[model samples]
Target: MQRHSARPLAALATIGTLVLTGCGTESANAGAEAASSTGAGRTIHAQKFMRLTQVHDETGMTLLEGPTFGKDGGLFVVDVTAPEGEPKVMRVNVGKKTLRAVHTDGRGTYTSAQFSPYDGRLYLSDFSHGEIVSLAPGGGDKRTFFSGEVDGAQMNPDDIAFDEAGNLYVSDTRGLSENEAHGRVVRISRDGTKATVLAKDLAAPNGISFDLNDRGLWFSELTEDRISYLRLDGEGKVTSRHTAIRVDGGIAQTDSIAVDADGNLYQGLHGRPAMAVYDRHGERLATVELPSRTEGLESATNVAITPGGTKAYMTVSGPDGGYLYTFDALAEGIRQSNGG
Candidate 1:
């Protein structure tokens, strides 16, 4: 079970706004009442807040990751296929709700896809190959941007983020066993020349995002069941560290995380059938349960919200395969590194 620290005022304020914009007061209040009675804080049924729909599906696609929005509002995702099929970077046609492969020749397991705000190119993390590759905007000109070992350990980069100056931050989840916590957070220079380790000894750091205020870097430790904040100096050196949220009952299996414009954090709870929402202070705001457990929607691995915050796109994986899901959201998402 997951436990949240007390910060009721911020949570209530967020709930109040949700009650006003998400639905009429009555329905939202009813959902809140039901969730509060269960001692799970203020909550709203996901369906009541937004409609959940499947935008795309394929048989050989064994996993799905990264539904990040490009500068032009187009969504990019990765399809991690079987051994016989190569992984693909796909672009989501938001209007038609369809997908088109952007990079069909990608090698290894593509775990995360991000569009650079400064250069307008797509960057992907190849977990199996231990490298970060770059692709042209329309999926052409694929090249290896960063690779090789970090601190004597191979790079098993899991997720990627960029700061305002175009410097890239990667979370390297590089442990073979459950007790071996050898994860690391590294920063690559804007020119892609120099690599520096900002922190080490992380227990499977998976999800990473910049705070809306640009004050610190936020990341999740999956095995440790905690989300933490790190303040970096002008040269990308770690100055301080703080635990934002930690699961008291053991592993929460947290994966990808996203931040909205108003400083709310939306995190994918891997083993649970829901997404956890937290305030800037790391207080629990609510949990939005995905619909239809029969569809293998329980394993949420990544989440991305649109710029206007009208809808949220999530990547879920299970024994059967992977899926891309979209639903209505309560607030606008933070798109840029500086929270513009």
Candidate 2:
């Protein structure tokens, strides 16, 4: 009787093992892949280059954005929260690590600082006033280039980029979260004569970049947590569009973007203290983390690679203050990376 019971128990154990092994192979493989992909990137720590915490308004917060190199090789940045009469557009000296205000004014929350390659003048996106403004190389002759409504709606211009033809592109992000479907990608002719709507009803398109060889236009959608690629025609009209990359930020949101000479993308995060690196094929390569990630440096917002070099700088802000961090890039920087 004892031998009979033992034999039956052993057979039952074998049956249970077979059932588990025969369970959905696809499900098992997916689980294994997800497990291996957790924390799936190389870790690269960055060094803090500049401290920007001391400069803030009554809100006691400072956001350093738009780390792009000017024609003079200095990095131009903007402070979106600086009060009127304060330095809203500033430049960074890489060697000396110094800051200088190039432009300032009221009712204009300049979020991006970019120098036009054609005219050799500086352009800024006024997020507060929904206007695209320009400044001379010496910060003089400030002018509003784009203002008021477009297609019977107010324009909430966020980030600005220039194409190879000197045509300007603007991301009008005003209605993603509210589902008002008012986001648009507007293009201004190189001659500044016509303003055409390239794409509209986007999901809060924020950071935009033009690819070399006119391959495609890369733009980040904040609400959907993804980067979109638009193939435009010679007239700045979209021929085809596709999703370049999708991000799983959890609490974080995608901000500005920069592209390298090899077409790799550096995406900034709003709540996370790290930048995600992706290859041209949308495969993630690494995550650039701040040395002070847990020490109050949480907002890693944008990155700019040194033109013709791999040196990269990121704009960061947190409860402690705003900061500039530096690291080595995965590839050489392209012209779009300059003030992207």
Candidate 3:
């Protein structure tokens, strides 16, 4: 693994002013209006209703991915600074607007962190170690939950989500380039003993989230710029599959996804200034344009909504540095797990 010198933390400052365009109403009101109106092709300027503020400035480190909320309302994030150096996991107090380190051991390359609704523990995906590690609610006592290959394939877990029954769905992003269909989604049993592939032949499957109704699983194919929905039976097996939405033209890469209580989907765009919003039936409801100078250069890597769905936190990665941004989301976010 290669190592690089760590850079100093940059002075904190407010990112940018909220500018709502194309629509007269504020984002919250516009979102409400867009949600109700049956008319298609209507655009809601999310900046009008939502206030974008910089919570933390990870100037020197690479905020690999995350913004998963714990039961206590604290948001968790990971820092993949150097391949040889230990990765750090930080927790953000959403209400207090403060950041603190939770776990920072030079163990493995950690990509994602999730709080299990059933177990009330935090689960992390160790990409370098090819294993899933668990931590106590307060980030203590790390232990291996699942490791080794699944069905003879090396584990390269990226994003993770849990169902109502405590089962885990992981996106195994095989490689960097999308030249081949090597990505797949794997499911680990509740007890963390058994693992199985739920879907395959995917081109860079990056994010996975359960539907608001709990009847389907939604995931994004980053390289392909497509989002898919999978219907599962009682046993959590994929029974049906279909492309939920596809992005074409400018800003075509799709990253992380989050669902709201109203069955609305919020997707992070790779090379666009806005995040795309979709209704339950796969209808494009709004395109939330964010304020940033690196609109085309940066990518909105991940998004997490609070349990109440009042606010949304998104991470943006670019040459300037990594930044965490928060804004008001009128709709309440749906609980990804059974626990609150």
**Top candidate when judged by lDDT against the true structure:** 2
172-244 in candidate 2: lDDT tens per residue?
7777436556788888776666777888878878788887666678888777789889998877789998888
Residue 322 in candidate 1 has what lDDT? 54
Candidate with the larger lDDT of 1 and 2: 2
> Model 3, stretches more than 4 Å misplaced?
1-61, 82-87, 175-178, 249-252, 292-297, 337-340
Q: After superposing candidate 2 on the true structure, give the runs of residues whose Cα lies further than 4 Å from its correct spot.
A: 1-36, 53-55, 176-179
User: In terms of TM-score, how similar is model 3 to the real structure?
Assistant: 0.79
Per-candidate local distance difference test: 0.65, 0.71, 0.64
Error of 1 at 65 (Å): 1.2
Steric overlap count per candidate: 0, 1, 5
Write one digit per residue (lDDT tens) for candidate 1, span 156-190: 78788888777888888777234467888888887
How far residue 293's Cα lies from its native spot in candidate 3, in Å, is 4.3
Candidate that scores best on TM-score:
2
lDDT of 3 by residue, 1-340 (tens): 1111211111000000100000122343334334435433445443322222221233223443667888787877765442232336777786776777677665556667788778888888876566888888878799888998888877667778888778888987765433568888999997999999999889878778898877888998877889999899889988999998876526347777778778788877755535677787877876665543333225556667778766777665444445565555547866752111
Error of 3 at 123 (Å): 1.1
